[model samples]
Target: MKVIVFDTKPYDRKYLDKENERYGFEIKYIEGKLTPDTAKLAAGYDVVCAFVNDDIGAATIDVLVDVGVRAIAMRCAGYNNVDIRHAFGKIHVVRVPKYSPFAVAEHAIALLMTLNRRIHRAYLRTRDGNFNLNGLLGFDMHGKIVGVVGTGQIGRCFIDICRGFGMQVLAYDPYPNPNAGIEYVSIDELLSRSDVVSLHCPLTAETHHLIDAKRLSLMKPNAVIVNTSRGALIDSAALIEALKDGAIGGAALDVYEEEAQYFFEDHSNDVIKDDQLTRLLSFNNVLVTSHQAFFTHEALEKIAEVTFENIANLSAFRGNRETYLANEVCYQCEKFGGDCPKKNHKNCF
Candidate 1:
């Protein structure tokens, strides 16, 4: 199949090309995202491969369908950017759901350690020969309580990391795993008692802005916030207010709500237009990284492998079998109709 992979970085090409040697698909990688204006680039391709930041809305879906694109493969787990309501019964959508959960979980731990130890600041001071440790005071993590929201694969891995530090774990998930050996509490209780809060949930109507002003207020005054999940999981404007008033000690974010416009690209010559992000950057306690939590070699290889497999499976079956595509959604039945096929719940049409 001819695939046009959009929003591709150099690393994506390096790994995808290495993996494509096995599948032997004609892959055309584009540096820009999959927006309405850029959708024409995939006019003759069989599959449109997108990344986390791609704008695969209703308009883009229409263009893809009109241009003979059969499958929409997301290289990442999250599908918040896609318009599932409109794409139902039209173009098939598939994703890499569980690719290297440890990559993201370990990154959450890295962010917390860097923020607490003032490692970023220390690196700058030492480079300038100012060797100062006056403001680098950090508390011990041995007895700290960590609140982990969403106890999925990545969240479980994060809990293990926290437990390794001798920290108590408090988790919140609609579907709790009793064998995970963590105290499952309500969101309110977890926020109030934790020294650090990490989010690993998906972006849905209920979870959008899950960490808002009310939740931030319920947290400890000196608690830290680390988010490697969806960007809209926390309200950015409200978070800025919390940071300004010292309601929270610090924040280390791997994603931002408005990051689609700026995350994967370089804008060094241009003035930043987003005031909220600008203010967040000015804070000494805030650390922001590009959405690179899942950029590890193992994670990328898995993403490429699964994404291609999804494309190939959809192309081969072209029928009613949906188990091949992991967690495929029948948006037609899920959103509009009440009756979904029991056998192939993943892709009921």
Candidate 2:
């Protein structure tokens, strides 16, 4: 099968090329993100492999369909960028549902620890020969409350880590998991009680801007928030306001709402035009890492393996109407509790 990969980076090519040896599918790599303008590059290809930041909206889907692309293989778990409703009858969409949850969960802990202890500031200070320790005060994690926003694989792993630190965990999920072994409280209660708030939820319409001005007000003034999940999950503008008003202690982020134009690429030589982003960078209390919570070796290997497997499965079931793609995401089915009305159909399209 012919496949074109968008948003191709050096690490992505290295791992995907290694995994592709098993399937031996013809693949092309492009450094640019898959947008409506770049969709034409997939002409004559059977599938398009995309990453998190690619634009898979109606316009891009239409372009892919016109170019004879039958399917989209998302290497990451989140599909919020894809217009699933519009692509339902136009193209098939599959994704890597999970890949090394520890990679992301561990990163969240790393962020929290670094922010709490002021490790980043310390490192910078010692490097420049100014080893004064006046503002490096930090508290103990033991016996502190940590609010986990989601109870999925990554969130569960984070909860385990927090437990190891002797921290109390309070969870909040619309659909709580009975096996999670933590008390599921309302979001407001969790925010107000937790000394640390870590976000691990997916980006959905209901979850978009889950942490806003009102919700931020519920948090303790000394509370710190860590986000390794989707960027839009926390309202950026509200967060800025809260920071200015000293409503929250600090923020550690691996993602940003307007990161598509900046993240993954080096812009050190250029001026940052986004006012919000620039303001965010100016805060010493805030720590920002480009969306790289899932950049571990194990995660990359699993992502490559699962993505190719999804593509191969789609290729094998092209003409068969009885076979169902397990990783295939249908908006209708997802919205209605996994009971797809078109169960007998091979693909939503």
Candidate 3:
């Protein structure tokens, strides 16, 4: 099958090319993100491979359909960028729902520990041969309470890591897992009682801006907040105000709401246009990374493997019109007064 991969990076090319050796599919890599302007690039391809930041909205979907693109293979778990409701009958969408959860979970802990212990500051100081220990006092994590906002694979992995540090774990999820081995509490209770609040939830109507002004106010003044999930899950403006007002002690973000415009690109010579992001960079207490928590080697391999498998599975049933080969976009089939083709409703991995 012929596939066009968008939003290509060096590591993406390396892993995908290595994995494609087995599938032997005709793959074309493009450095640009998928958008209306670039949608025509997939004209002759059988499938379009996209990443987390690519825009697969209505307009792009229309263009792809007109150009004979049969399927979409998302390399990431989140599909918030794609408007599945619009691409209902025209196309099929498949995604890697679970890559390496440990990659993101470990990165979240790394961010929290670095922020709390002032490792970044100490690295800069000791490099200049100045070894003063003032202002570097950090509390022990042994007796601390870490409130996990989601109990999914990534959240559960993070909980296990926190337990390794002897931290008390409290989790909050609408569909709580009884086997998570942590106390399940209300979001309000988790916010008020946690010494460290970590967000691992997805971005959706109910979860967007989950941590807003009121929720920020509910957190302990000395508590630390870390987010390795979707950026829009927290209100950036509210977070800025909280940081400036010292409402929360610190924040470590590997993602941002407005990251699509800037992240994964180098802008060292340009001025930052977003005032909220600019202000966020001025705070020493806040740590910001370029949405790379899921960029580990293992995660990249799994993403490529699952994405290829999704395409293979769909390609295998191209002649069978009765199969729900659209993957998770089957929900949109109801709009056309037709039953979804797939019998099982499980998420595609």
Candidate 4:
């Protein structure tokens, strides 16, 4: 199949190219993201491969459908960018579901470890040859309560890691997985009891701004929050307020709510306009990464593999004629995967 890949990067090409021969696909890589204006580039291609940041809204989808683009293969896990309801009968949408959950789960823990151990500060100081260890003290993670929101594969893997450190795992998922030794609880209880709270939920109506001003207040004074899931899951403005007021101890974020325009790009020379993000960056306890939890070698390979498989499935007649093949973890294209939400229907589906 002939595929036009948008939002191409050096690593994306290097990794995805390794499996192209097996899939019988020739991908035309475009460096820039596929905006509505640029959606015309998908003409004559049978499929379009998109990244998380690429805007595949109504306009873009209309353009792709007009150009005879039959299917969309999302290289990442989330499909919030796509308007799935509109594309249901017109085009098929598929994604890479659970591509190396260990990669993301481990990165969440890595950010937490880096923040708590003062390793970020220590590295900066030693680079200038300060050699000061006076304020480099850090506490241990043993016997602490870690609240994990969303008991998906990544959350379960994170719980396993925390359990290895002798930490108690408190999880909050509408549908709880009982195999991980995680005790499911309410949001208030998880916030009040946890020494560390980690977020692993997808972005939906119910989960959007799940951690708001009121929820922030419920957390302990010394509690730490880590989010490697969707950015909108936590309210950034409320989080900044909590951090400024010392309501929470620390925050380690690999994803931010307004990261689409800036995360994967190099805008270091330009002045960043997001005031809340700027203010959050000023704090020493807050650590931010560019949504890179799924950048591991294993994850990249799996992403390419699953994405191609999704394309293959859509090309074949295995799925229904109205809609294309939907990824198993794709809540956007499909219904809520296995009844996690209290509601019967998915928001965008």
lDDT of each: 0.89, 0.94, 0.89, 0.86
- lDDT per residue for candidate 2 within 1-349, as digits (tens), equals 9999999999999999999999999999999999999999999999999999999999999999999999999999999999998998778999999999999999999999998999999999999999999888888999999999999999999999999999999999998999767999999999999999999999999999999999999999999999999999999999999999999999999999889999999999999999999999888789999999999999999999999999999889888867878698887887667776767345455
TM-score for candidate 3, residues paired by index = 0.94
**Candidate 4 C-alpha lDDT tens digits along 8-65:** 8999998889877688787899999988888899998988999988998999989999
Per residue, candidate 3 scores C-alpha lDDT tens digits across 156-262 of 99999999999999999998988666799999999999999999998877899999999999999999999999999999999999998999999999999999988
User: 112-231 in candidate 1: lDDT tens per residue?
Assistant: 999999999999999999897998877899999999999999999999989999999999998899887789999999999999999999998889999999999999989999999988
Error of 2 at 308 (Å): 0.6
lDDT of 3: 0.89
Question: In model 4, where is the ten-residue run with the lowest total lDDT?
Answer: 340-349
Deviation of model 3 at 200, angstroms: 0.8
Q: Which regions in candidate 3 have their CA more than 4 angstroms from the true location?
A: 324-329, 332-349
Q: Which residue pairs in candidate 3 have backbone atoms (N, alpha carbon, C) closer than 3 angstroms, thus clashing? A: 324-341, 324-342
Q: Model 4: how far is 173 from its true place, Å?
A: 0.4
Error of 3 at 264 (Å): 0.9
Relative to the true structure, candidate 2 reaches a TM of 0.98
